[model samples]
Target chain A: MSEAIQPRMIDFKPHEIPLEDFDISQRELWSEDLKMAYFERLREEAPVHYCKDSEFGPYWSVTRYADIMEVDSNWQDFSSEPAITIIDPEEDFPLPMFIAMDPPKHDDQRKTVQGSVAPANLKNLESTIRGRVQTVLDELPVGEEFDWVDRVSIELTTQMLATLFDFPFEDRRKLTRWSDVATGGPETGVVETEEQRREELMECLAYFTRLWQERQEQGLSNDFISMLAHGEATKDMSPEEYLGNLILLIVGGNDTTRNSMTGGVLALNENPGEYAKLRNNPGVIPNMVSEIIRWQTPLAHMRRIANRDYELGGQTIKQGDKVIMWYLSGNRDERAIENPNEFIIDRKRARQHLSFGFGPHRCMGNRLAELQLRILWEEIQKRFHMVEVVGEVERVPSNFVHGYTKMPVVLHPL
Target chain B: MPKITYIEHNGTQHEVDAEVGVSVMQAAIDNLVPGIDADCGGECSCATCHVMVKEDWVAKTGSPEEGEESMLDLNPERQGNSRLSCQITVTEELDGLIVDLPEFQF
Candidate 1:
């Protein structure tokens, strides 16, 4: 007798399954083409959904834009203490960053380094970023396929991060690896086990500690490491706190921008008409950058714990209930954005989406992220006629970091 | 191009030509004016670019849109004359506009 064949979960179409059976938290759901289909269905049928059980345990998925805004703004009711992922941070390994803290503490720690990416600082860093971007682009082999994610996005962002920390340039790749390890889980292929993840992150902490001491000896400096070491609020942070904040800065600077960089290329290749529009008028690069970030919607969701009984999206969120605000889903909400699915580079009010998040805990380095993207697009227009995607784009497996692992592309010189 | 004056909270003033059709935030950004953070880059999603329109130019600058107003509400010190510079487009009539920059963008 022939062995019974079982259908693979990835083979199941989202539409084939009943709405009641939908569970968006499954890491497998993020990798399949049905990801968006599931989000679309959730937005239409159950904007505020409850998954009774999943890998990350039962949680409420707020899929609509207005509801997400409510969750983001009402921090008093929805707390971000401990950690901000669907899977709670391990009790043995507590990493406390400012984004996961509440009120006065969050404000104090945030202000410690907010000036680094302030508009004035960004203006100063513009020329340096431009030079680095040019060098990265100029070095790429024209008309030859390469992984744009690694060769361009990761390299450029890692370089910038190294500059921000004043770290040794040759060791810059460690920043990229650390950023990946920080957010990646066992399924992402970046790490095989939770023990391995913790081990790698401890190495990261030790390395940063050495840099912290070195920066302290040099007195105050504009670089992030020195700033944290000197700032009154951040200077005395615990080792765990330091590691948490370092991971925050690394992932914040690395993943979002890098993914959007890859996403932009794929987006343009898929929407050639929009690409034509952008090529016709490179002046639209600034607006198009926002559109790319919006379309990509990196860092898929941020989870918060309900501090008190609260009513949201016509549902009562009981105290201690885990509420996840799916930023990717909200960015694609039909009610919030016009023609949210299609990639439109010239969309008026393009920045109306929620990629950088909203309210007080909104990304501090958002301007820096936008500046990096804007410069890259502006430079791309100058040198390349097109960055042709030559192979299937590989996506990161984790549901948290919605990003590309590899993308083959060949640059076409103008 | 329309000339505009930006008065920082510390009393430093910047006088620059505001490119017609661009937002006030862009003009400040172009001129390196210190206070308009425009962190969301004129998305109307952030109130970092909050400015107090001069009394005479309040009518010309216009009121905030509902979305912009909602974001402005996030600012605890949001005043009657408060306007997100990014939401106010530069026009011929907006020439010689003077706006007071807030002390903190957060």
Candidate 2:
């Protein structure tokens, strides 16, 4: 971690902070869920705002919905290479995942593995997902408070990740640990040091490397490892490349819907009217799923590098400057979404939201994520009157993963 | 007004009066047709609005532009006749056009 001094973003109100000092990258703001007001101010004042200095150094923030659409879609001007988060990826230990690579290279590698999670395969996986969801939900004790984030959210998504990888069912939690460790570091408490973070990631690479070797001997298969091992394009991927892609897949498949699962329960409990809307008409589950994903906006922002100087929102982003497209902020931008702050389940054009990001590099596992959430909610509706939020909910103390660490909830059976 | 028929994968046909110059996607959303998610709200960037034009209507609808083709390239289920409904503008030439909605969007 950079030894740069921490900015006490929470001490200053959103409006009180000077525009130049508006560093939304601060962990305190996201941990406390205090970043929204700051983003609202930025979208209102400076849609293409820049912070001259921060712990991660200087960068620009694109907060408006349409501006994000422009930056995200134009990978030509806004490069995704190097990294896709606010902090620059660790040097010396580079992870060359496709999400961070530009076109041609990005498209080639993503094409090889995207098939495993695309709509065609998702159709086959639906029954398996629903069955696991049933088992996970059925196993939970009703009327007793439990950590929904762990018991339901983590378990369900983790199981889905395992199924997608055809990973060892007994050792599935390792996937969760690796996913957490990949995105987190000493500050978030996943690992005590940056060196340890890299060590665990290498361990992740070794394990997957073994899986790759084991699966390479077998015939072509449906799981990600088998597909990659057998894929014409990915067969000879470097260890770093394999690990980078694995982290991308594991975290991509795990954290997103995991947070959405917990977020939906809290969203419903917070907005009882929406819960009632759900109970009255279960048919709205699909639409509600989109709304929930939008509401959570799980991965808060995607970072990009300006390939060339470009003008957006009347501000000129110079080439080589790091840029952060705040999807969380864009989702709440009033200009695009109607009544952006409210959680309306039946909201029209819910899928048009920025949570998926737009353009070629848009999320590869979006369909799987949606299917998982939709089925999970469908199962929840049939089993319980409410997954009531019964205790203090702890938010993840990081900007990238907008999620809950612990959400105490007690299911009231119908 | 052009009568564009959106045939779902299951053979359910929804024939709606598509307004002149309106995209085929907007007509379905207006008519509350079951298929065609149109997630990007008429931007050809998202391939979710994919639809297969019938052989008879292919000439009238035309081929996808570079942007549309690039997006469709990412979709595994994309067929030779696949065109994003959001990119297909409803016009007099397409009066009797019929397109088949795929089983699911990418």
Candidate 3:
């Protein structure tokens, strides 16, 4: 009989980071080069590893894809009530949204906002989304180098989401800024102090409150806010719940999609041959979109509270414990994916990646995000012959979102 | 075979002959109905195949399961008659059934 490999505690605390300054690139979030190194180590050593006495308090980092899916699917055992992120929610943090709620209530509230992200709704917006993608691509500096992250990816996604919500296009940047402050811990970029984040949160709440009030009074049926304002869920939602959900929708829509765009561009540039494959056969765009999301694995991890004591991957998790589902690691699992390290555009079953998550909490904006990405790739193919990396890509200094802050790309028009 | 009619939110109605064993969602997809994508392949997870049973046929179609009912809450134009079409099998009794596609199903 084969003996079980003796479990060994990997000393990762020598690399422990503050909750605020937890940038993945510093450790490994910057580019695929850095990430692959760390992922390989994690997979080899402790796939379901635990870390103690670090930032965000003591927690388990569930790395393997199968482990993440097991934890995510068994939500009853792995609760979402305590904290949704690695960092414990401060006293001033906004009330929990549906994503943080458990069954029954979570089921009800989630449904209220589901329609806005449903595939049918997304199909209707395809043309407008395509137009927005084209608009962003058209505005790109023809011969000069530009930060695709800011000028192209973020702007294009922000606009698409804004239009879907019927948000005032002029002030849409506020959504991006708030999402950054809300999710941006001290790791990379601007780390908002607790007080500053609270102030920003309150300010955003005030703006949303006014918008909700106006929508209620006007009784318009054109946007998501209006639908939420007059929906069945409104009967039960407190002002805090309403605002918390609005914030979740905006953040959920913004950061992840934005990161996917930036990640896609970086992936293609890094894999020029794959880029050539995509350019040569535009028919591969759909699969390419799946591969990008799989390869990038944006939204690194989602935290879930253990509702009851449960065992996973031979590890015992007590009730009320925290489990971090590392989607980034899962997407690269050697067992689940063939050539998991390589970015193959036509990898069969690439769409099965856990980036958008799986089961009940799967991303509601999946279709819209895919539509925008498809159009963006289509437009880029039409306009540019090659996108050469001109400068260093700046990565967001956080583990939660795998994204680029700046990617200087020289667009060569066809 | 049962005849099913799907009237989109935009008022486009598609009539098709459906076998009793298949689901209304399967029937819609088979006929290339525009709105129902059924991304999850009728698992009731995607909620892409949401449809509002015509008022007269509401009782005949029966209430949705807990999963489908929960999913309907997320539908934008969720009416009292909302049901995940994937969950509703097209039995002989449901012939001439009418379902309205919601304007939005994310």
Candidate 4:
């Protein structure tokens, strides 16, 4: 077992310490307000800040827009192999998914399932997505406050995930459960022990293994599972590899868009003028979709292992050092974006943001994600005057998934 | 609607009508033109929508901006006439525009 590393002891309280001294990796700093403040300070004072120790151990942070782009694009120096999270991979139960892989293999395996999210596929899925979005919105209780994250965001994204894998419709929430377990920590209350998390993920692997067999027997199909079962590169994956890739797709298809869905509501409610502007000009929905992604930054950071010693943004990143690219911070980088703090729906060049990442390993389902958001907002404009934020918002506790856990909202119909 | 021709690297040609104000990338997407990935959904973050503006139309299409150029720089196959379609807004003057999609975009 890898020895559990303890966080470096800090003598001063977080709020009492000056903002410039903040460690961006501290989970407590991830709360919306505190995190934003910390990012603001980093972009101004230290774009490439190094932490001697974190829960994940010593790492360098690329906090500014251009610096992150440099790190993300130069995969030769900063590789994605082994892992992409702050925590090291579980040595006992290593799951080798393509998102954490380097080129050649990563390119091949990613291409295997890339067909499912092609623009052509998105065109076919658009009506189905719209139908589902309308159904969820229509079923929403007007004038009563409810957790939008659960009712709207989770439900809609789960349904889309079910469609992707063609998993049993009734047991679709299993996908959601496994996804949460995959990214969850002990503090999140999703799983108390590593063994428990492993057990649940193994259950997930078993379920998909059955589906894999069924799909192979049925020959080729358009679903993601069938694509993997039939693809030249992925047909013979080991059980662990299969589980790794499945978790990637599930979490990729789920959390990013799901969180963005919730974040869209939160951003709009917080910026009433933007919401009113949206209502007045529904033509901006497509552009606003990109802006929402920028503002939301669903996945907070993607860690890259340095393949060799490298110099970037006035700092040296030694070989094998874990480097974190904070997408949330870069998305708010004033140098890269004008008025980075404000949520402007109609901003020019709205798509120019770091939320989807860049280079070879950028988010595979980016267009589909945008399609879902665009359709949801399109339907929203036709019905609701405003989706009022009615109660306190609870953000996900983890630093990795920058998402809302619960947000009470009431829809005011047009 | 202005008609634009997109030639795939494989020599397959698709002629589609592009709405003014919408992007040429959007026009290709609307027409289901195969090669233009537009993976970032017109973000200009990904150069998946790279197209080589035909020789005759190079002057009309203009050049890629700094952001688009940086994205295109990552594409080894980028040409002198290469433009990120997302950055090029469709307009009446580009009615008969011809853009060749590189094989890599597929």
Most accurate candidate by lDDT: 2
lDDT of 4 at A314: 77
Q: Compose the digit string of candidate 4's lDDT tens values, residues A255-289.
A: 99999999999999889899889988999998899
Best by TM-score: 2
Off by over 4 Å in 2: A1-9
Q: Model 3 Cα displacement at A62 (Å)?
A: 1.6
| DockQ head-to-head 2 vs 4, winner | 2
Residue range A1-414, candidate 2, lDDT tens digits? 555534353675789868988998889988888889999999999999999997789999999998898898888888998989998877888888989988778877888888988888888899999999999999999999889989988998898889889998999999999999998888887787888988888888888888899999999888899988988878898888899899999999989999999999899999999999999999999899999999999999999999899999999999999999999999999999999999999998888898988888889999999999999989998999988999899998888999999998888999
Candidate 1 TM-score versus the reference: 0.84
Recovered fraction of real interface contacts per model: 0.09, 0.60, 0.34, 0.09
lDDT of 2 by residue, B1-106 (tens): 8899989999999999999999998999999998788877877777888999998888888999887887888888889999989998888889989999999888
TM-score of chain B of each: 0.97, 0.97, 0.94, 0.95
Q: What are the per-residue Cα lDDT tens digits for candidate 3 across A1-414?
A: 112222223334423433333222233333333555565566656677666545466677787877787787565577777457777766655567888787777776777666666666666788888887777788778788888888987898788668767788999898888788777644443543556666787888888788788888876575778877787865357777776777778878888888888888788888988988887899999888988988877788899988777887777887877778888888888977788989999777566678877556778778777877888888889998987788998877566777878889898988
All candidates' TM-scores?
0.84, 0.97, 0.78, 0.83
As for candidate 4, its clashing pairs are none
Order by lDDT, highest first: 2, 1, 4, 3
| CAPRI quality of model 2 | medium
- Which stretches in model 1 have alpha-carbon errors above 4 Å? A1-8, B1-45, B53-98, B101-106
Q: In candidate 3, what are the lDDT values of residues B1-106, reduced to their tens digit?
A: 8999999878998999998889999999888887876755566665668888999999999998766765565555677888889899999999999999877556
Order the candidate numbers by TM-score, best to worst.
Answer: 2, 1, 4, 3
Which residue runs of candidate 3 sit more than 4 Å off their true CA positions?
A1-35, A185-192, B1-106
